[model samples]
Target: MTRMIFVNLPVTDLGASMAFYQALGFENNPTFTDETAACMVWSETISVMLLTHDKWRTFTSRPIPPATSSEVMLAISCESREAVDDMNEAAAANGGTADINPLQDLGFMYNRNLADPDGHVWEAMWMDMAAMPTDT
Candidate 1:
């Protein structure tokens, strides 16, 4: 069987969080969605679970960090640099913050950073395997 990953995130507003992820090209899976959480599908193998703060507390004792504290950076791989830029554009247009840092170009890889309205950091990146440099 293929492995799948589910990233659970805490959100203050379920509706807004859903919209924020949708803008970043995630499709909502209603089969696993409810008032407390929304299942956002990035692909067949990846899904993000947006859970309200209250709902989140049920599963963990750790306090939800405020928006100002960025503890994690969620990175997603894109097909090309254009796709990365497109995701950043869509994020900016959908009430999310875009371009937290300058564009990255390392010969074979490029990336951009974006933050959702609630301040979850997401890095969109593209890499050219053929152009990659290896010492080995």
Candidate 2:
């Protein structure tokens, strides 16, 4: 069986969060979504579950960190530099904040970071494997 990853996030507004993700090219999976939670699929093997605070608490008793806190930053690969820029722009156009981190350009790899309305950081990157520098 193929393995899959489901990233669950605690959101303040379910509808707004859904819209924010949708703008970034995620498709909502209604089968796993409802009023309290939404399943936003980025690809066949990757999906993000946006759950309201109440729904999130049911899964863990740990306190939900404030939006300013950063426990982890999720990343996704892009097809090209243009694609990375587009993703960052789309995120900013929506409810997300763009350029949360310094732009990275290392000849073969490029990356941009953005934060969702809930302040969950996401990095969109593009890499050219063939152009990567190799140590002699």
Candidate 3:
């Protein structure tokens, strides 16, 4: 069986977080959703667990870093360049903010960055398969 990945992120508001993801075309998985967290299904293999700050605190005794000051950024790839633009638009319409950087267009790839309500950065990228290297 193929391995699946679940990324857990902290959010200030569960409902708004869920709505933000939904705007990006992700659907909530009812099977693992509750008041504390919602399982957002991005694909068959990828899922994001949006956990409320209070719930996330239970996992660690140390203080949780605020999204604005997070050390790592999350990136998600789209099927096409148009999809990347669409996602960015959706994010803005759903309460997220677009990044300040200029758009990147390298012929073979296109990318844009956005920040969620809590300021977690997410990059939406699209890569051309034709430009990718193949195994020897």
Q: List TM-score per model, in order.
A: 0.95, 0.98, 0.91
Please rank every candidate by TM-score, starting with the best: 2, 1, 3
Off by over 4 Å in 3: 132-136
Across residues 21-107, which tens digit of lDDT does each residue of candidate 2 receive? 999889999999999999999999999999999999999999999999999999999899999999899999999999999999998
Off by over 4 Å in 1: none
Best by TM-score: 2
Global Cα lDDT for candidate 1: 0.93
Q: Against the unseen true structure, what C-alpha lDDT does each candidate score?
A: 0.93, 0.96, 0.87
User: Candidate 2 at residue 79, lDDT?
Assistant: 91
Tens-place lDDT per residue, model 3, 1-136, is: 9999998888899999999999998999999999999999999999999989898888876676776585567889999998999999988899898753578888888899888887778889999979976789
lDDT for 126 in candidate 2 is 98
Model 2 regions lying over 4 Å from their true place: none
Backbone Cα, N, C clashes tallied per candidate = 0, 0, 0
The 10 consecutive residues of candidate 1 with the worst lDDT sum are 94-103
For model 1 the local lDDT of residue 52 reads 95
